[model samples]
Target: MGNAEIIAGIKIPDSQMAKAVTELVRDTETDLLYNHSRRVFLFGAITGERKRLKYDPELLYVGTMFHDMGLFDSYASETERFEVDGANTARNFLKSYDIPERDVDDVWDSIALHTTPGIPQHKRPTVALVTAGVEMDVLGIAYHDFSDKEREEVCACHPRGLRFKHAILSAFCYGTIRKPGSTFGNVKADVLERMDPTYKRENFTEIIMGSAWDS
Candidate 1:
């Protein structure tokens, strides 16, 4: 494997494992998601560099690439949060390659917590960067941190299609719509709320009041 594609000064890892995961994701996910995952890796790596963080690029690459696996039908689980589905899928794949448990755990955490806000940023570098990359690409959080050239370069390579905002939201809705309970407290609840008018958000206050424990 050759380091053939470099975006924003970060070289795409060419390790055998890297190539394997890349091939898996590209084959399994739609172009919208495949390209988004690649952009996540590039943006994550760039952020890691800017922060002067000491991290393994290969591990981060794997994490970013697999972070959205749960959103696809092949990996989606009936009774789990989409994030957990993705984490478990990545865990299984890495364990197959006999990756060390510690590294495997990091990748698991990265995918599981990418949609979570506040917490991941405090975890390991790989974990934090996964969420950072997602936020940057999806919500445009910290959009100004990257230079115009960097943004253009990454998008030029991955090309966040003409209607990325709506398309991604649709993807999210499609993935989790069947398992609405899984979105109880997470951000996907918002996706369901927007896409499904019939979606009834689980109200925290109502749950507490309905609980058997009486004050």
Candidate 2:
């Protein structure tokens, strides 16, 4: 028999396989990352509540938990961006449970586009909330949306390591530098630039000008 998902210590209700997914995330990610993922979920759920958006909380939890799994060696790929890898992992996890394809797709989009700005918010509530949650944790975007008490509560539960920004940035670099080509045409390219000084992404203007159709 498969191991039962744990929930005694978790603050959130273990809906469906959310506890299992959360446990997997904690096991796979570094402490800093795991805490960050948990905080993202809190921030996102709060935002969803504030906006009065109707969404599946468990789906959001699953998406946020797996959002950064691509950074871990077991899940990271040389060809795909970390986001895609994470999305694929989340998708597969959901499929194994015989989840509805539409719900699975929502989780996939949420994990894949968590880093993307402007677009995810236009997507479904699940996707949009994931992006908002991630942005709140990493960039502190819309930080004011939640009160000090709310922020303190989440942070208290998932203490931020000292120098969290630097640590997370370094983690991002570590995942992308070895696979520099995968960083091109996306936000991950900037991470490659900061970490590997010798790395340079292709210029879109040059590509457009050099295209055969330009003549």
Best-performing candidate as measured by TM-score:
1
Candidate 2 vs. true structure, TM-score:
0.92
Q: Which candidate is the best by lDDT?
A: 1
Clashing residue pairs, backbone N/CA/C < 3 A, model 2: none
TM-score of each: 0.97, 0.92
Clashes of 2: 0
Q: Model 1: per-residue lDDT, tens digit, 1-215?
A: 26377778888998789999999999999999999999998898899999999989999999999998998889998989999999999999888697789989999999998988999999999898998899999999889999999999999999998999999999999999999999998999999999999899999999999999986
Give the whole-model CA lDDT for all candidates, comma-separated.
0.92, 0.85
Error of 1 at 128 (Å): 0.5
Give the lowest summed-lDDT range of ten residues in model 2. Answer: 1-10
Off by over 4 Å in 2: 1-11
RMSD of each: 1.2, 3.8
